[model samples]
Target: MRFKPHFEKIRFIFGAIVVVTISGCFQIFGSGPATFIKKSFNPSKTKQAILFWKGGNATSGNSLQVSIKGAGDDLDKAEVGNVFTVDDDHGKARLNPKAIRLIWKSDRQLNIEYDVNLRTFIQLKRFNDDTIVYRTFKPVIPANHMD
Candidate 1:
């Protein structure tokens, strides 16, 4: 007897839903999933930031990392205890005046905010998928200065 293609497709979809539901249930009940989801969606409110230095290439690293430049006249003089938020559609980083740095090797695009600086970058990878793998660095500079 021959099986119908439609039946196979339905079976595949049903199996996938079962797998997802099982995982979601586990996540809902465990701290691991809760913490993972929290961090994944809201990284900007938890990570720390450091100063930025040139000479770092984005193409030669396992993960893309972002750092704030602290030498600019306006940025260097900003209050030391200030805080900022950095985010992409996929994740976010919460940073304080210490300066914000992030390494996103699995994200394609990101939106970062530091003090008054907001910038975005497109991560480059080997696939046509929307999952970009890149890092972005933003500083507490004026909007006009961002490129």
Candidate 2:
């Protein structure tokens, strides 16, 4: 009867040790929640406008929405069929289409078809480029008109 009580006590202690060892291993070896880890590793692949027209009239084709892709946003917004450019970065600047008269990048230039009065014009092609270089004036016949 004495040996019976000792055996029960040993059995209880051995079972408790096994349970605690298994539990400790789980806590030490397991990573954080699987979902949270996966979410942090992979980001959403959404197409956001790296450069977008915050304000532009798309109906008249005054300004175009240029993107990383060769294709641009088909928003037609313009006033008097004119768009202005400026040296200001991240700020709105007035553009005079008459100032340059013709601007192009590569073979792609501003394709504007205008009536004699200059009331309205349709843009047949858009100047799509990542960078633009301007030429200084050298005195032309009409001035401000590039030949």
Candidate 3:
């Protein structure tokens, strides 16, 4: 059966609305769901580091994030952190989830260790009066071959 002109226009508009609505949902929810990994507090219990992984789409890999905030602040509310990404192979990320670690070496220092190969997006050396120390067990390699 053939569709009437007005009916075809209505169907097209409805399809457009559905596409926009779904895309809006994705934007509201971010790339994908985030999973909490670990948290560590300084010796003085004043600041804390929260670790999490955020899923990514086909073009981008999963992300490992470490946020530093006041000890009492909520993890979701923490705004300052470092972000690292790894290749996304189909649905799997090229990172070993267990290879990441966070430790408080001192009241003013936070130690972060992850796979040396992951690409770092944001690396904050200092936050407020605290210092963030990042390290990988093995020698480091540049993220981009430009080096």
The candidate scoring highest on TM-score is 3
Show where candidate 1 strays beyond 4 Å: 1-3, 32-147
Off by over 4 Å in 3: 1-29, 77-97, 139-147
Residues 9-63 of candidate 2: C-alpha lDDT, one tens digit per residue: 9999999999999988765654322110000000222211122222332222222
lDDT of 1 by residue, 34-95 (tens): 01001122233332223322111223211122322222223232222122223221223222
Where does candidate 2 stray beyond 4 Å?
Answer: 34-147
lDDT of 3: 0.68
* lDDT of each candidate versus the true structure: 0.32, 0.30, 0.68
lDDT score for candidate 1 against the true structure: 0.32
Clashes of each: 10, 8, 0
Ranking by TM-score: 3, 2, 1
Which whole-number lDDT from 0 to 100 does residue 30 have in model 3? 60
Best model per lDDT: 3
* Candidate with better lDDT, 2 vs 3: 3
Of candidates 2 and 1, the better by TM-score:
2
